[model samples]
Target: MIKPGSRWKSRVCTAEAVLIRPPKSEGLPQCGGVDMAPVGEEAAPADMQPGLDQGCVVGKRYRSEATGIELLCTKAGQGSLGFAGAALDPVEAKKLPSSD
Candidate 1:
């Protein structure tokens, strides 16, 4: 019987036994065999082109035009609060300058 820590040794022995045996010739359906195109002969363009503006920015602030608040993306923090839960009256928002 194999010990708990000797499990790896048993697995290696089993693998060695399988490797020493001659491979059986059972005809299997082989899909397109090794007739691949030469490297760079018919290679498709990169899935994504580099240097193209893919909506990724290193440092920038994304703000909402409808709100007067601006978000500083350079700092580690949440964006300016939107019109969520505020005790300010509706007349106060109207009194403020238009964000647009």
Candidate 2:
């Protein structure tokens, strides 16, 4: 089970992430359409490749509503944040209105 402040790295790509929000329960965190391993863990052979073409970008945050899990991109790679079979969309920063 992943918890808040937990760090993980992409097994398939060069992407790395850290969990900001923990999931409600034990849920599998995936990136680039493959499961992610804990930081410092050996990379899985099955996840040693990019699953999606779009790929994840550096400095982007990804989250899931169903599980309430949030991840921040550390290193960029050809892997998009995903859970189960669905891809997680990048979190957009809200812009503040001008005080003019």
Top TM-score: which candidate number? 2
The per-residue C-alpha lDDT of model 1 at residue 59 equals 31
Candidate 2 — which pairs collide? 12-47
- Model 1 per-residue lDDT tens digits across residues 10-78: 110111000111113321110011111112244222222222112211133323333322222222211
Model 1 residue-pair collision total: 0
lDDT of candidate 2 over 1-100, digit per residue (tens): 6677888888667888888887676766777677888988777645533445467777888888886878888888777777775677788976888889
What local lDDT score does residue 82 receive in model 1, on the 0 to 100 scale? Answer: 17
For residue 82, give model 1's deviation from the true position in Å: 6.1
